[model samples]
Target: MISKDPRKGGLAGRVTKLSNSEQQNNPLHGVRLDAILEELVAKLGWEELGKKINIRCFNYDPSIKSSLAFLRKTPWAREKVEQLYLRTTKKGRK
Candidate 1:
């Protein structure tokens, strides 16, 4: 049965709708974590990334697979990486 109220579908439906709306506004929406790492490495190199983000994965012994694993588990580090990507690319776009 269809509900007249949007919230009547409950939490899952509301979360899905919120997610879709957020995706529309997020530049990193459809972008993969690996892709973001790859682009950052390509543009900045491991040394620079480590300098900027100060993460052990990028500093000590970097590999795309390892970095991806670390970033996936570490939200703060992942957010730093995404912010760097956005900041760097935004300037280049101009």
Candidate 2:
């Protein structure tokens, strides 16, 4: 049965997909993995994030090369950084 609504399923669910505006907020999207780490290090600072999160990457003067390698392999650390980014951005609004 053909639906009358033209918008029924034509990329309807894709609306939530990455838009250009949102793409700006995503540090990792379309970015080199090493670059993402560099930005995180620059913005958050390794010492501060290390103090807060107690992760090895932030603790040991870790390089973008090593951190990128670790984060790519470890889902849990990636999740932690994503969560931190969300929290940090949310706080910046106030």
Question: TM per model?
Answer: 0.75, 0.55
Q: Which digits, one per residue and each the tens of the lDDT, describe model 2 over residues 1-94?
A: 1124466744332334666887776655564556546666788888877876777877996777777788888878877876666566543344
Q: What are the clashing pairs of model 1? A: none
Best by lDDT: 1
Q: lDDT for every model?
A: 0.82, 0.67
Candidate 1 accuracy as TM-score: 0.75
User: Per-residue lDDT of 14-79 in model 1, one digit per residue for the tens?
Assistant: 222345766677787768989889999999999999999998899998999999999988878998
Clashing pairs in 2: none
Segments of candidate 1 deviating more than 4 angstroms: 1-19, 91-94
